[model samples]
Target: MHLHCYRWTGRGADRARESERRPPHPAFPASPLPPMRTCDWLLKPRTRIDASPATVAEAVAWLTRRYRSAAESFLHPDGEARIGLDLRLHLAEEHLAGGVDVQWGIWLRGGDFITAAVICCSPNRHAPHPCPAAS
Candidate 1:
């Protein structure tokens, strides 16, 4: 299952932009922004399919491409876009970490579309030795 998240910027929206340029002062109060609406989190292509390795690889590629495009977009003109930050694949899930399941995080943003912070949990853990039964 894909977990989707999103945010929108109407006219006079600059909170996302300001946050990046300057670190918030310790005494600065938080802005009370309104909650995102249901209609805002929609995507054009709504086809469902198996999320196999191939699909994931494609998604990764898409994220990578978007990153470059967005970075360029932000750099041009008056130096702005609704997209403040697109942190795709925030953390790498290394099997080196000791655990039964691998865990990771993602972050992204897209207008009128769901930017999912997708996490994958592996059923199998890394083992130095093969199962005794197999041996």
Candidate 2:
């Protein structure tokens, strides 16, 4: 497994330059913009994996648990607060042939869930696509 952590500064030029430096994964095409709202601004820790769905689910579950616990530390009884989870799953043919790339993220504001989403993108070369309308 390989891990690549990114820190987002909310700069479009920075993102574009970064993208230019690294070619998209052969099995997971790149997008002009990510498919989820938070995904566009939140930092992502890249994980390279060749694993089954069960393994992926397990990893997500673990991260969810940890996020919940950490979120509490950021909470205050008399002020606004925010916490979230941002996950990106990139699967190659060698790992899961024909499997789509997945991106998921959620945000909690003032201890309430304000957003949650999951998006899938085709693992093929094509023009960039936009994210689906949020529900």
Candidate 3:
């Protein structure tokens, strides 16, 4: 008989990539930089907002300015996103020519911290390291 061990890597390192994952609970880093690692360095825009926006619309606008394009099929005739927070807005998420899944989203933690990012989730399983699409 044999036992197999699973290395319990951080979900961010697992196949289902997301910006939602954060450091373990209760402890907060004193560093000014956003708590980012791995693919984030390879994916997001250079600007990161450390302060929260006054409203969801503010956040949406910030993300929109960074990414001017959207998946036409996912948006309205006005080029706005189908989903809404309190009212409505546009979100950018689309598949690249090579089948790369590109997604943009906002990360929020209370009224003090909020930021937006764009990540090109590897076409293959997992992140760039174990991903066949990486070269």
RMSD for all candidates, in order, please: 14.5, 12.0, 16.1
Best by TM-score: 1
Off by over 4 Å in 3: 1-22, 25-48, 69-88, 91-135
**10 residues in a row with least lDDT, candidate 2:** 1-10
For residues 49-102, what per-residue lDDT tens digits would candidate 2 score against the true structure? 112233435444443443454355333412322222432222222222233333
Q: What's the candidate order when arranged by decreasing TM-score?
A: 1, 2, 3
Per-residue lDDT over 5-99 for candidate 3, one digit per residue giving the tens place of the 0 to 100 score? 00111222232222333333222122223334433323222232222334433444545543343222232424333344323233232222232
Candidate 2 clash pair list: none
The CA lDDT at 134 in model 1 is 25
Give residue 128's error in model 1 in angstroms.
39
The runs of at least 3 residues in candidate 1 whose Cα sits more than 4 Å from the true structure, single-residue gaps closed, are 2-54, 75-87, 90-135
